[model samples]
Target: MENPSYWAVVPASVRYDKKLRANAKLLYAEITALCNKQGYCSASNEYFAGLYDLSKKTIGELISQLARCGYVRLDIVRDERQVVVERRIWCAIESPFLPADPPPKNQGTSPENSGDPPPKNREYIKENKTSINNTPLPPTGAGIFAAYAGEHAGLLEALQGFEEMRKAKRKPMTDRARGMLLRRLQDLAPNDPAMQVRILDQSTFKCWLTVFPLDTDKPAAPNPQNDRRQVTNGWID
Candidate 1:
C-alpha cells in the first residue's frame, strides 16, 4: 500500500490549480535551498519575494497554500520584523517496487475464459445511485473518515516520516501517540469482554521512533577521565 515514487502521489500544487503552478515551482526551489543551508529556521515571504523579484503578496499566498496542502510547512518564531515561516517541501524518494505487477501477458484465459461477470461486481454497479456513491469521501469526525483513510493510507507512513524529520517534538511511536491509538482501537472494537490491547513480541518500539527525539532537554553524555579505557571495560549498570 506504501508508494514512494515521485509520481505515485499527486503533488498538491499539481492538483491545486494552474494559477499556482509557476509560483509553486519557484517557492519549492527556494525551500530546498533554505533547508540545505544552516542557520535559517524561519523565513518571510518578503525575503523570498526579493529573491524571486515577485510581490510579497504572491509569495505569501503561495507559501500559505503550500503549507495547507502539505507540500511545504511553516514554523513560527517571535521576531521584531515579522513572523518567520520555515518551509517543509514534500519530496518523494523513489521506491524500487513501484511497478509491482508484471506487464500484461497474452494468455488463453482472456475474453473467452471470462465466462460471466462477478455477482458482487454487478451488485456494486447497481448500487451506484449517487454522484457521491462510488467516489472516495473525505474523512469524517465520527471516526477516522474512511475516505480520509483510503486516500491517505498509501501516505500514512510517508506523512509520519515527514513529521518526524520536520518536527521531532511530536513523536510518531511515542507513548502518547500509542496511547491515542489504543484508545481509538478500543472504541472501535466489537463489544467482546475479552478484547484488549495486545502487544506482540514481534512488535518493537523502534519503528514509531522515526520522528521523535527521546529527550530534548537532556544533554549529551559526559566524557569520562578514562574515556578510552571505559571502551575496553564494559559499561556497568
Candidate 2:
C-alpha cells in the first residue's frame, strides 16, 4: 500500500555519516516516513526488498547497518518456543511531529528599556499595475507535480532531472511547459510509474525537449529449470 501523505526527514548526521551506504541511507529515510504514523515501522524485509527490487537478505543487512549506527532501534518478539515472531524498528531521534521547545524566559523582554521596538514611520507605496505586474504568480508547476506525482520518489526525481536538463541547455522550462510535459509523460506511460521514470530519464539524458516512445523489443525466452529453482525463502516479519 502506498502512503502519499507522509514525509521523511533525515537529519544532517545521518546524511553525512560515512559508515552508512547509499542504499542504507535511503532505507533510513523510508523508516522515518513509516514512523510518522505510529512512531515505529513494522514492515518486513520482504516488503522492502520487493519495493526496491532487491533480495530480502540485502534489506536485512541494510537494516542491521542502520541499527549498528545508533540511528534506529529494533524490537523483536518471540513466542514460548523462543521462535522469532514480530519485529519493529524505531527512529532514535525525536519525532518531527512533536512540539518544539518553548522560547526562553527573557525572550523579547528588556530590563532597562524594552517593550516592542519603536515602530518606524510607515510609507505606503502605490501599486504599479500598469508598468510592472508585481502581483505574485502562483507556483503552478510545483503544485501540478505534487498532485500528479504524489509520494512517488522515483518519478519525482526523474522529473527533477528533466527540469535540470532544461536549465543546463539554457532553456529552462516555464510552469506551463513543465505541466504540459508531465501530461505528455503520463499519456506515454499511463499505467506504469516505472515506465514514466524511464521515459523522463531518457529525455533528460539525451537533452530532448520532448519525450520519445520507447523502442519495442522482443521478450526473451524463459528457462523452466531456473524458474523452478527461483523460490524465495520464508522470512519472519
Candidate 3:
C-alpha cells in the first residue's frame, strides 16, 4: 500500500459538479490521499470499502461515477491469461496538496517522512485492521491451500466464505494462520469435502472462531475397530 498523503484535495470543478454524488466527492479526496507516489491510486474496492465502512459494490459504483464525471480515469491491467493484475485510478487533475516535487518512493518509515508507527494497543490495531485484512496471502501458502481444494468447487467456495467471514469479524487470518486452520479442518473432516463445507459454513453462520461437527454427523475416530464417535449437539467433549 502506498503511503497516504497527509492531506487531500477537492478541486472546484469536482466540488461543484452537480453530476456527482455527495459521497463521491468525499471519495475523490480519499483518492488524492492514496495517490501518494504513483500519481494514481491502486487500492482495491475491498480496501476502500473497509476504510469507509461501505460495501465493495458501493465503492465500485462511486468510482464509476467519478470516472463518468471526468474527475478520474480507471485503468485495468490484466495478465496474459486475462486475470486482472491491477486496478489503477488516475486523477484527471493534479491536486495542489501534493508536493511540487514528490518525495522518493518507498520511504514510508524514513524519519523525515515517517509513515504510521508500530502498533501499540487495541486502538491502534483497530485503526490498521483494514490494511491488515487486505494484505495478500503469501503465494506459497495460498498455492498449498488451493492445491488442497483442487477442483472441488464447493470447497473453494467454502474457503472464500471463510476468508470473508474472518474479515467481517475483524479477525483476518495470516496465510500461515489460515494454513493451520486448513490443517485443523482436515483433521476434523479427513477426506470428506461435504463435512468440511458443513464445518466451515457452521462456523461462519455462528460467528465462531473454531469449527465443530454438525449434530447429525459422526466424526471418524481412531480405534482398533475403526469406530465412529458421536458429536452430540455439535459440541466436542
Among these predicted structures, which one has the highest lDDT? 3
| lDDT tens per residue, model 2, 30-108 | 7765542234566667667877888867898899899899888887654332223446677776533311121135756
> Which of the predicted structures, 2 or 3, would earn the higher lDDT when compared with the native?
3
User: How displaced is residue 170 in candidate 1, in Å?
Assistant: 50
Off-target runs (Cα >4 Å) in candidate 2 are 1-5, 36-38, 98-237
Could you tell me every candidate's TM-score relative to the true structure? 0.27, 0.39, 0.43
lDDT for model 2 comes to 0.62
Off by over 4 Å in 3: 1-5, 97-237
Candidate 1 minimal-lDDT segment of 10 residues: 93-102
Give lDDT per model, in order. Answer: 0.37, 0.62, 0.65
Q: Kindly list the per-residue Cα lDDT of model 3 for residues 1-237, writing each as its tens digit.
A: 344434677899999999899889999988776663435666777677887888866887899899887888877654332223456677777454332233355765563453222224223223322232242433353454454564355876887788778889998878677767777887888767889999999888888776777756876566633223435335443
Best by TM-score: 3
Roughly what TM-score does model 3 have, to 2 decimal places? Answer: 0.43
